[model samples]
Target: MATILSLSNVNKNFGALTVSDDVTFDMPEGQALGIIGPNGAGKSTLFNLIGGTLAVSSGTVQFAKQDVTRVPAAERCRMGIARSFQIPHPFVGMSVYENLLVASSFGNSGHHDAKAECRDILDRTGLLPKANRPAGSLTLLERKRLELARALASGPKLLLLDEIAGGLTEAECHELVETIKGIRDSGVSIIWIEHIVHALTAVVERLIVIDFGKIVAEGEPSKVMADPLVQEIYMGISVDDTAA
Candidate 1:
């Protein structure tokens, strides 16, 4: 498979604290890459660097073979990179369809038809029936789906998802995982940072575990999670004592 994104010797620092230390990886096209880590592990910061939300302190970001370390966020969106925040923050007053339309128009250079794209986005995201409802009235699950739809509206080849299943109920997370699977089936490469392990395992063929700013494990989902180091990180997080 072709490489969709590459991080080479990436480094990000906050004053004297190093958030990302010599991080390197490649997200292959049409594949799902799962990133799991404890809170404050610089997982989201890694996404910010790839999606152009934050400037890297040092190193390179290559997307689709073009170096995008200095590229502005909006330009990166137009270049086929789109990310959803951990917390869904849609335009509260706008309808779901309207929000998607705005993303398609602005993020994709105003080339898409507003009405057509809005309907298609809603349909694709399982939000067609809620298209006319105000975004603020959505439940947590709906909000998560909208966040995904907004990213999809940008027509991304590489999607960066940040803890999308954080607050969803178990059943809702399963539904959302299916939605994500549909997205992957449509040929988009996904790099999802999620704490919902089951959902991640269901969708991602490969998993990468990061700790203290660097990846400690990367391989098939079951294999990576079974590594002693990976098991150690998740040891106290859940009451379920079964091994990964």
Candidate 2:
């Protein structure tokens, strides 16, 4: 598989605080990579840099073999890179279908049948039945589904998901896992930042653990979770603490 996205020596700073420090990785085409980390680990900041929502202080971001380090967020969407925010913020007044239509229009670039594309996205995301309903009236699960649907409507080749499964029941999360698996099977590469370990393990082929703006482990999901450093981060207790 060819490298679809590459982050080399990427660094970001907010005044004296370093959010991302020398972060680097290569994501292959059609691969689902799961990113797990504690709060304030800079996971969201890393997504901002990749999606062009924030400027990198150093290093580079390449997508589909093109250097997009300086590209604007809208342009990145046009280039087949789309992201779903951790929080769902759909247009409160618009119908579910209309929300997706807005995304399709913004990222169309005259290449796809936007109408058909929106319909397909609705179907894939299990939102077709609610197409004409107001987005703000939906339940939490429906809202998250709509968020994923809106991102898919843009026809992205690389999708960045930020804590998408944060607030959901086990059954709802399982439903989402299946939906994401279908998307992965359709050849869209995904980088999902999720705290729900079970959901991430269900769909991703590789796992990456980040702490303090740097990678501490990468490889198989189960193995990485069992790593001492990863365990420490999640358990909130160090090895010494356990020993004592």
lDDT string for model 1 (1-244, tens) is 8898999999999999999989998878999999998777899999989999999999999999999999999999999999998878999999998888777887754544668877887987789999999999998878988999999998888999998888777887887898899999999999999988989999999998888898888999999888988898876445443433
Candidate 2 backbone collisions, by pair? none
Clash numbers, per candidate: 0, 0
Model 2: residue 228 alpha-carbon error in angstroms? 0.8
lDDT for each candidate structure: 0.88, 0.89
TM-score of each: 0.93, 0.93
Return model 2's CA RMSD, one decimal. Answer: 3.3
User: Over the full model, what C-alpha lDDT does candidate 1 score relative to the true structure?
Assistant: 0.88
RMSD of 1: 2.7
